[model samples]
Target: MFLYMLIYLAYHGSRWIPRKQRLKFQIVNAVVITLVLVPQFYVIGRSKSSRYCKQPLLNNLSASIAFSFIASGFSVIFTLIEPIPQSLWASYHLFGLLSCGEGLCTTILTLTAKDCVKTTPELYYMSLFQTVASILSTGFFMVRGGLWLTKLNPGTDLSGNNESPAVPH
Candidate 1:
């Protein structure tokens, strides 16, 4: 969820900056994001050392590492493709899809992990909240994309003229 939020913010927040400065900003953002994961890796290592290597704990640790690596790869790819205007939009769209998938998976896991929720009600609620938020944002993006496509290709008449409804001047 944190990863999703970070990606969301980075995607939208970078758009306003001048093109020349974006590369620098992205470099800094990548460094910060990678640095932030250090503590998480440490915590996971400590959990294992403390003999709390339960399935949930291990699953979370693995997911964290996997997500971190995937995010780093995305950062590299985005940096490489930044020069292409269309690539940026495509990246954002792909991220939206990824967020939706993640939300669905998280919701399913939360629903099925009855024991986990019973043991940790707070975590369950937090997971539910993240899932709901992701789904809402993804829905908004889908609707927005549909509207954009419609605007791009408004209906045409048989004469092949654009068929926007007549409007008074």
Candidate 2:
């Protein structure tokens, strides 16, 4: 991961940015990645260590609140960075990096939460549903954001025209 970041920055992000602004871009992006990763690392570690000792997060009110805050922070950080990348390359790379991180988060949840799912079948179904729904929504919003970045309206039909279809309702 560290090596990938070094190569990614040197070859991709910094190469396209102005020489004078390259350092700032790299630093800010590195910091952003770090900020996003720390909590994920914590969650992965906690999942491993808490297999037997910890209470179910869904069963505990305060713990659920704390988890909610962490989730919100994760979302808010992504939201804040959504418009920062000006170029298509940068935007796609940022999305790739974030999606890579999200892959780990999703993988860890699937692996570590199996025990809980065994005890509660609904948890499995709910997680599956949420995972699919969130992925779809995230992709959709990113596409819309990209359209906005390119000075296009997402509501318009992009099939070689600006006309939007009328809603049946």
Candidate 3:
């Protein structure tokens, strides 16, 4: 639990780094994400670890889903905290990146740990489900925010065709 919190902090804290230092933050973000993913995969992959865990497989998967939702919430919180106007864009991008990273980490770990899952179709569906859910949730919030902005400033272009608003302090 402590390790997970540290990884979360590393990823979340990176947002506070100045723009000039963003590259460093990105690197740190990547490393920390990798660290968190390792344990996540270990818990999910079929093995003694999964079997010995207190909860059943369904419960474990549910917990994983909940974790992603919480991560999404954090992404939103971090975006709101950002001083820049384009923070939503950054947040969504980061959320997507984190989703993909976690999915890949789990998939690779599953395959490497065992050959029990034989069907590629099952994996495909699972991946699709995760991808769709992550995108829908993130996009929903982003669009909602945009709609609010448009409602607030009628003169500003509200159409989806309009270019993204410039970042202002």
Q: Give the TM-score of candidate 3.
A: 0.34
Question: Tens-digit lDDT track for model 2 on 1-169?
Answer: 2222333333445446655555576566556556544543444344343344222423322232334344434333333342434574455456446544553454356455666655544434344443454466556556756777656565556465656677798
Candidate 3 clashes between residue pairs 3 or more apart in a chain or in different chains: none
- Model 1 TM-score, all chains together: 0.54
TM-score for each predicted model, relative to the true structure: 0.54, 0.32, 0.34
Sliding window of 10 residues with minimal summed lDDT for model 3: 49-58
lDDT of 3 by residue, 1-169 (tens): 2222333454457656675666666565556546545545544563443333222332435455556555545533443454545765465556556555554444444434333233333333343444454455456546766778787855456464545677799
Q: Compared with the true structure, what per-residue lDDT tens digits does model 1 show for residues 43-116?
A: 55552323421225335445655775666665555545555488766865575556556667766766665555
lDDT agreement of model 2 with the native: 0.45
Tell me the deviation in Å of residue 142 in model 3: 30
All candidates in order of TM-score, best leading: 1, 3, 2
What ranking of all candidate models by lDDT puts the best one first? 1, 3, 2
Name the runs in model 3 displaced over 4 angstroms.
Answer: 1-12, 49-54, 65-81, 84-169
Q: Where is model 2 poorest over a 10-residue stretch in terms of lDDT?
A: 53-62
Give the alpha-carbon lDDT of every model.
0.59, 0.45, 0.48
Off by over 4 Å in 2: 1-17, 47-137, 141-169
